[model samples]
Target: MFGRIGRTSVKHPWLTILAWVVAAFALVALAPALKSTTDQADFLPSHYESVQVGKVQERAFPEQDQPASIAVFWRDDNGPLTDGDKADVAKVTESLDKAGFNLVKKIETSPEAVSPNGKIALASVVASVKDPYDEKLLESVKELRKKAAPLLEGTSLKMGLTGSAADALDSQESSGDTDAMIMMATLVLIIVLLGVIFRSPLIALLPVLIIGVVFMVANGLIATAAEVFGLEADASVSAILIVVLFGVGTDYILFLLFRYREALREGQAPKQAMSDAVANVGETIASAAGAVIVAFLALLLSSLGMLRAMGPALAISVAVTLIAALTLVPAIFSLLGEKAFWPSKAWRKQPKHTLGKRIGDLTARRPGVVAGVSGGVLAVLAAGVLTFHPTFDAGSSLPDDLESVVAMEKLQSGFPAGQTDPTWVVLEKTSDGKLEQAEVEAFEKKLAASGFGEVSPGVIGAGGDVAQFAVLLKEKPSSDAAMELVSGKLRDAAHDAAPEGSRALVGGLTAVFADIQTAVNRDYSLVFPIAGLAIMVILGLLLRSVVAPWYLMLAVGLGFGAALGSTVWLFQGLQGKDGLLFTLPVIVYLFVVAIGTDYNILMVARLREEVRRGQNSADAVRHSITHSASTIGAAAIILAGTFGVLLLAKNSMLQQMGFAVAFGILLTAFVMALLLVPAVTKLIGPRAWWPGIKSDTARPAEPGPLLTEAPAGDRASV
Candidate 1:
């Protein structure tokens, strides 16, 4: 199948190129933009209690809504507020309230909103009915900041905004800049690395230009699919898509280009070399991509809508990249031929001393020693996994310098820590009529008296059958303590004490985070096994061996563990952070396990190819590693370097993901794929393909002595 694709692409290069151009352009022009939401409730099914509670609040309390943002004020002199400072804060609040800005529903300030110490005061700004991620809300936040800056100039007091609206505003501004930063970093990484390795400007820039089109095409198709299927993309998918395309896209291209170059040095014509390149490595690339696609599609099993949407979106991207690597990438290189490496001229001469040769010789000569050392490094790092702590504190993850985080800290100093984002307990008379006021008050008292903290008087909902009470805790909303209260003590108290014929539901940011934790834990159990099983199936099919896939996957798994454990050790143990972000494990699995699988597949496939030749298992291991080393090394560095750029992002989650994935890819290439996999293959021999192949006996080596030559007898076909 890949041979035919290569032949057709080579036969009609211009036509193939033209088709891609047209498809990419039309898709870019016609497809709708993808839409995403910031509300955690929006990403969950209605079955979860947090989601159900959100529905009740939306339906029952349409008049007085949750505040979109909160402004905390204090004296700049760092003392108790004087009458003058208090008057200035009141004046600024009144001014902003009367401005009547779009999306600004109302602003509320009262004596009760002031802190008991008289050092701080609070104002709540509510937005009109709209999506939490809506641009209008962000605009209103910006406008509010603009107007308040001048209003507070003459005062002794200062104000800082915190909560959802402020976060949305910050995320919106940063994501745009983040995209640009990632793109620039990715481009520079690719160009510099490719330039250094190939010593050709065309080689450095070709993949960039090619993958840029892939990005446009993938995004357009994904956007179109989202529209057709009503998929809810995560708000950050665009940024992620950027890295995935460049990282994986470059990987596939490297697979082909290296083979193409090696074939050229072996004296094959441009067309024949291109054909052989695609034919040889095509299955390996396809299998690697297939593994990733299946893993991503496994997210369909995730209870979280964010993963469901992201899973397919990313699968589409890999599918597009795979096709381009097989068809479009080959066509262009086929046409460029030997001229593609014009200035380098190195393709004509194989260097006598190469690192690939050295590593290959070491592995081939001392398989046991190499495997032992590589496996030991992973085992030591994997020890850190036992100490992993998942951080639920969103505020803590935000840069400490961010306004929302800063303002939140200021608010904690003056008010009940959780008051900035209170948990609302809703009671509904489940059987049908108006809720008895006595029952509602009793429920409120039960919540407050249970030791969680203050509870506001009940506010009747639109229907008399429902009532709402705001509960504030001593812990910050995003803290583990707050989530435990919401998920354990507070929820248990509410459910157990509800009046007859009524039910109590806990809602609010803390409850929502707790519910998110539940969903993620469920995914860890369900999604990981499913994805791992699916990838194993892909490998089994690609390798024609059930045995090879198991240990290959095992190696990849170890690599992922080491990557994750190292991240936890760095951020939590060494840095003394309260915890790493809760969602990082999932990110690491997707990038490290799924993506790192690519390196393993390439190495193992080449090992099998060498075995099919006349060489003994040990020689095959040496020969395969020698030949595949340059390709894997350069690709790993490029992909890892691009992800490493994520460390430059200000967001803690991005930084964690960047480090985990980058380090993981390098570990897979240099350690697992390079040393561990080949060494194990040498030990397992022909039986590793048990039930698939009949013989493991060595064939006599062929006549070729070229440094870059493939093993002698016609290599086995996929």
Candidate 2:
């Protein structure tokens, strides 16, 4: 099937290229922009307690809305506020409220808003819409900051905005041109690496051109899918997509080019060599991509809407890159023919692989020693998994200099750390009748005495069937301590002290983070096994041997552990970070396990091919490694380099992710695929192919030398 595709592409290169161009243009012009949501509740199912609280707030306590942003006021001299300062703050609040900014519903303050120490005061900015991250709502936050500056010119008070809306605006502004920066870095890295390896400007620039088009098409399709299906893409999706397309896209292209060059040196015509290249590596590429797609699609089982949406989106991206690899890449290269290697005659003959030969010879001679050492290295790194910690603090990813982050730190000095976004404990009469006043007061007293934080007096809803008690935790809302309190003691206390006729539901930012932790834990259990099983099935089908798939997947699993463990060591141990991004494990799992599988498939397929050519087990291992090592090494470096660029980002989350994925890919290529897999297969011998192949005995018609001529300065024979 792939041979026929290669033949058609080579036969009519212009037509194939034209089709891609037209499709890309059409999609870009017609597709809608992808939309994302920042609301934590949007990512959770309605059944979760936090989500349920949002629904109840809308229906029962509509008028008692949470502040979208808080305007924190402090004395310029860092002293306690005097009467004149307090009066100026009130005037500024009133003036800003009357300014009529879009989405600004009201700005409210009172004597109680002042801190007990009189060092700080607050004005809560409530929004007309519930989504604090809404663009217009964020605009209101910006406008409020601007208006407040002039009003405070003569006063001793200084104001800075903090809270959901202001934080969102600051985060967006601080990450200025991050997407463009990643794109430029990835392109430059690819071009430089390719140029150094191939010594051909054309070869280096070819992937950029091809993948640039793939980028346009993939993004258009993702946007279109989101619009039609109403999927909630996260803000991070596009940045991730850039890496996936360039990294994986370049990988598939290199696979084809390597095989194409190999066939050419073996004396086939350029067009015929291209056809053979497609036929030889097509199954391997397809199987590899299939594994990645299946693993990504497994995210559909995730309880969080973000993972669910990300799964199909990434799956779609891999699928597109696969098509381009088999079709568009071949079409263009086939036309260029020998000129693709212009300015360098390296493609004309087989080059000596000094490092490849030594590694291959070692594995061929002592499979057990090689396997033991490689496996042992992975095991040692895997120990770091025990120290893994997860954090849900998105604010930590923002620059400390950001207004919201700075103000938040200042606010903590005068208020409870969780006062910015307090947890709400709701009590509702189950029978839709008014709750007894005594019961309401009793519930508030219980929550206050629970010792989690201060609890406000219960505010009854207009319907009288529902009431809310805000608990200001002593820790930051997204902190581990706050989450534990909300998910454990506070929840237990609320349920235990609810009025006899009422039920208690705990909901707020901390409650939301606690619920997310639950959903992620559930995802870990369900998604990992399903994805691993699915990839194993693909390997089994590709190799036609159940035995090969098992060990192959095991190696990939070990690689994942090593990658994650190394990340833990770097960030949690060496860097002294308390925890990694909560989603880091899932990100590392999918990228390392799925994409890493590609290298495994390539090596195993080559080993299988050499075996089919009637080479002995040792000979096959040596021959396969000698031929496949350069391709895998080059491709891995490019992919890893692209991900490594993320370390340059200001956001710590991006930096951690960048390092994990980059290091993981290198480990997969050098250790798992290059060393571990070949050694194990050498030890397993012909039985590894049992139930699929008859024997490892040399076939009379398939005669070949085990070792080809060594390049200059290398051993004459293996």
lDDT of 2 by residue, 1-718 (tens): 7767778888888999999999899999999988987777889998899888877777887776689899999998989999888888889889988999898889988988988888999999988898889998888788788888889897888899999899889877776677887788889988997788778899999999999899889989999988888898987788889888888888888777776776777788888888777776777788889999999999999999999999989999999999999889888988888899899886665577778889999999999999999999998898898899999987888889888998998799899988789898899899766988888998888888889888999988888888888989999998898898899988888899987778999999899999999999999999999999999899888877889998988898899999999999999999898899999889898778888888888888878777777788899899878877877887788878878877877778778998999999999999998899999999999888777666778754234321111111111111
Error of 1 at 127 (Å): 1.4
Alpha-carbon deviation at 583 in model 2, angstroms: 0.2
Candidate 1 lDDT, 1-718, residue by residue in tens: 7777888999999999999999999998899988888777788878888888888887898666778899999988869988877788888999999998788888878877888888889999888855655788788888888889999987888899988788767755643477788789889989998888778899899999999999989999999999999998997799889888888898888877877777777889999888877777778788889998998999999999999999999999999999999999999988998778869776576654366668889888888899899999998887788898887775675667777777888888888888778898999888978998888878888877898878999998878988988988889888888988899989999999899999999988899999999999999999998899999998888778889988988888889889998888888788787888788888888788888788888877777666666667777787777777776777788778878887877677678888888988899889998899998887787878677544667764344321122211122110
Clashing residue pair totals per candidate (backbone < 3 A): 1, 0
Which ranges in model 2 have alpha carbons more than 4 Å from their true place? 98-100, 139-155, 173-176, 694-696, 700-718
RMSD of 2: 3.5
Minimum summed lDDT over a 10-residue window in model 1 is located at: 709-718
Among these predicted structures, which one has the highest TM-score?
1
Off by over 4 Å in 1: 170-176, 692-696, 700-718
TM-score of candidate 1 against the unseen true structure: 0.95
